[model samples]
Target chain A: MKKLINAVEDVVVDSLRGVAAAHPDSLKVDLDHRIVLRASGPVDGKVGLVSGGGSGHEPLHSGYVGRGMLDAACCGEVFTSPVPDQITEATKAVDGGAGVLHIVKNYTGDVMNFDMAAEMASMEAGTRVESVVIADDVAVQDSLYTAGRRGVGLTVLAEKILGAAAEEKRDLDALLALAQRINEGGRSFGVALTSCTVPAAGKPTFDLSDNEMELGVGIHGEPGRETTTLGTAADVASQIVEPILADRDFTASPVIAMLNGMGGTPLIEQYLVWGEIAKILAGKGVTVARTLVGNHITSLEMAGCSLTLLSADDDLLTLWDAPVETPGLRWGC
Target chain B: MKKLINAVEDVVVDSLRGVAAAHPDSLKVDLDHRIVLRASGPVDGKVGLVSGGGSGHEPLHSGYVGRGMLDAACCGEVFTSPVPDQITEATKAVDGGAGVLHIVKNYTGDVMNFDMAAEMASMEAGTRVESVVIADDVAVQDSLYTAGRRGVGLTVLAEKILGAAAEEKRDLDALLALAQRINEGGRSFGVALTSCTVPAAGKPTFDLSDNEMELGVGIHGEPGRETTTLGTAADVASQIVEPILADRDFTASPVIAMLNGMGGTPLIEQYLVWGEIAKILAGKGVTVARTLVGNHITSLEMAGCSLTLLSADDDLLTLWDAPVETPGLRWGC
Candidate 1:
């Protein structure tokens, strides 16, 4: 409730204004449509990459809008899916001579709206738009807002890899195949020590006792696999990593590991958790080729952490290492 | 207190293990001495940069140890200054043929301990060492841990600018003078909505009423200027910016502004605050040539933010734009 915001209704637009103001050289904001576009986007013959979802998980869809990442991001209200209109506008804005690719998370509202937007873009402008839904959270098969597994931490990885591929001027079909490959290979699990409060709600989304944690919690505070007793970082790491490895066998290929923070947890704790997880992976003989530890996809001020493991080949690793200059993720540029 | 930690005693070392694991290509960790060193360090004739302090303000000293930044960072227990021995070892480990420079915050323990380390390095190893102490916080003339002003957000900026300068093969004396100039040109102010709990303490460092906030708070939860009623981001922005601009004349030149989060605040809220701060700066005719908004320097999981503005000329701006490959900050590599 003590958030640094003016009014609840103005939160998304205001934050976008700040984003535009902060990255004037790289990002261009269309406030009226609530879409953030790359300042130098729509490469003449390259497929445009667009992704979006609810607002609270920052540095995700919007913060990733720049060269080598996302061409445009259609921002919705906090924890609410962007309307089809917004997504359509984002699609049209980033459409070059090549087709557009929509990288969407697996939420019912988001999936449906993005589909509608794709149809609208195709019908209105004859623009070919391909949609790739990311449902990599190994938490639950269904959640409060998602019919399938909720797209969690893997979305960030997918965006980075797909963005790099798009920057290489890969056709829409190839990008779609890569996106599906990433979705198939990536798995994520999250634990919430505390629930986040939406600005409009002005109260925590859920109640979690100090000694308890939500195992496999969704990004929007949806019910997880179980409400379990809170344990040490080692215990938490086992709980998170076991389910992820059980769901996907990472031993077959070199893995890219991401130990992501859920807003409220500090970097030191993230590193601590990563250390424990690394030990577990090493014991299991998982070869981690790349590791990222920070708050990439966060649930607004929720104290917890998530783990994402992607089975990566040399190609995926190369794409990940490619220069990316987004506000949220940057490297090798 | 809820934190993702193993044990109170192992927090620093365990976290360092994670850091070393996550950034094997860029960083090397010495667990016995609790020092994070650049994997490729002691560049033949470049002045080595060494900075260290307490452990809690992460990504401050430890995360900054990489190429184009600090050659070494000494890690102490949470909220406790690094021992002279640890600092001396770090100094020795990173001492190139040219010399070494120590960037110390203005905390009494940090300044004193770094000074002792410098003396030890000079007397015992015959290594030349120079020190630059940052006292940029305009919050208070003195605080619980500092003799003069508390070094807050400006340390990040100073380390960055000095790191770039050192990479250009600047000598120890020239880096020291540049550091002092940066310290004089920079000012910082912070606000805390809630207090953070040290792992050993198992409780909050300080308390504020639910409806109140600590204005001008230090990174260690020390008392601030006043406990004021919670206000909107606009109101808070005015309170933060007015004091900073009043204390210095940022209008004389372009400014590099950073709106930094204190761990627990969400990026959305930080951007919202930055939006408000940007409006105020524009109204005041302060030209911001560059801006950074995120959690760079943090106080554990304290829910608040701080702002640092450095007056910049063409030279400083160029250095600020230099490539930095730290875990906490990165661009243009």
Candidate 2:
């Protein structure tokens, strides 16, 4: 298949350099090291935040490195976690006097790599490192094998809220706590209209006929919770959100809603899906106080969307409102 | 043809409601009038930045509302510009005494509607409104019916940089000028491996065979400038970046590069593409200051990627370093 890359092997590093070149203002490229960070050094009084996993979920790690979000983001090979060395370097880059917090999605490699980096960072004197492993996707009922639900969508929300808290000059403890709150409260579920091809795999991750879709696919394009006949946008949204609402009791509180594109779905359709999702949530008396529609977090070019709902309280709300300046998920005053 | 929406007509409104419910702390939805804003009132002296366009480019407008970026985002229907009423509403919602600046992508409908809204806001007392249109896509060589090149990717970078400028208390004219500079200095090009389905259209925007791709597509699933045999990611990136480099003389200046996913392209592949792009740029002697990889602007289910390069000066870099808080992009002090 034709692509815009050189040898498939050099794709990841070359892309990281390109990103650093493009956003010199907000990001830096460690060509020798594969780390992206806010151009400025870490803030003096605030704890530094770092997060990354696979290379393809663009704007997730790298795009999200800036003022209100990640201090640095490491890109691994596509769908692969950065090695501990990369994460360790990122920790060093963002480590101000304050500690660093790693927001890791619950994927086997991602968890392990980030965990290793955190441990490495902790070994340094005065370097307080902590992690919030986000497993927001409800796709996998069996948490063990599939990294306990495969932290699909909530990573963006968690970064924004936590970035805000960090911007507020909160201590590492408070920042970590808030990150956990956002992650714990948010539940995400996604479906795939088609399977995506991993370059190494060189084919569709799974097969979906014209009239079928895989519900609850992993970010790396793994099989979803179930495969069913293709349904309408509303039906798909319901399938993704129902489980999330059920798990989080979204009906009882106002929620932050995200109808994210699975790389291939257009924003035109994301809004269409969001419209239907609103009706479902309204019917359940779930007050959707805030909503985001479009591809915030994506699964390569999978033709689908995921729904993420973060139940909120005042603190979470305040943190969500905190100001941030990352390439992804920035907001608040 | 199945979609996640209730009725195609109600898509925008319903989606807005869902957004409101989802982030009550960070975003408040004006259901009666579809406008999203930071839940809090306009900051006392900070510039109120407002941007909006068709709904297909998620996290572009709405996902960007917050302290460091946009104060409000008015969302229109899929691939269609928001109406003037919506823009006016968003203006009022975000019009702090500091005035409002509309960050518009260079699309026919978006420019017209935002222009109208700016005029409307002028009529409304105590509101100062200005706009800057971003025409950064270099894919369309022709400057005819489609209003020159469609504003495909640079929207996110412009918003974040200009948003930071606004946050820094730059006067309206300065902010608008900065916004213009970002637009002028940035250029992008793309290639599509597969066409995405527009939910309302209920079919692929275009068709591609198993081994082919369309080059230079717009974010709303619009056709690219040409159709060619699919090529390697490096070749694609070379084509995408060559025009950009040639157009702006990028080899002479520091650049901020982006390898954006057109939804369906996997990150693994994007990295491959990025890696290739970096080599090409490096060979050209272009000093890449920073970079971003992933899906920032996307077309629905389109399996492709775009490359964006923004030539930066010291001022733009400063703004990039400035703190920002938005749902889509965030960063530091």
Best by TM-score: 1
Error of 2 at A75 (Å): 7.2
Q: List the residue pairs that clash in candidate 1.
A: A333-B333
Q: Candidate 1 — which residues are off by over 4 angstroms? A: none
Q: Give me the displacement of residue B237 in model 1, in angstroms.
A: 0.4
Mind giving the per-residue lDDT tens digits that candidate 2 earns over B172-244? 9888778777887889888888776665787877788877777777776566677787776656777787778
Model 2's CAPRI class?
acceptable
User: In candidate 1, what are the lDDT values of residues B113-213, reduced to their tens digit?
Assistant: 99999999999999999998999999898888888999889999998999999999988888988998899999999999999999999999999888889
lDDT of 2 by residue, A73-106 (tens): 8888878888999898888778788888888888
Q: Which lDDT tens digits does candidate 1 get at residues A77-118?
A: 999999999999989889997999999999999999999999
* Model 1, C-alpha of B65: deviation from truth (Å): 1.0
- Candidate 2 error regions (>4 Å): A1-4, A9-188, A220-225, A244-261, A267-298, A307-333, B23-51, B65-74, B82-133, B141-144, B147-184, B218-225, B251-253, B256-258, B290-294
User: Each model's C-alpha lDDT?
Assistant: 0.93, 0.75
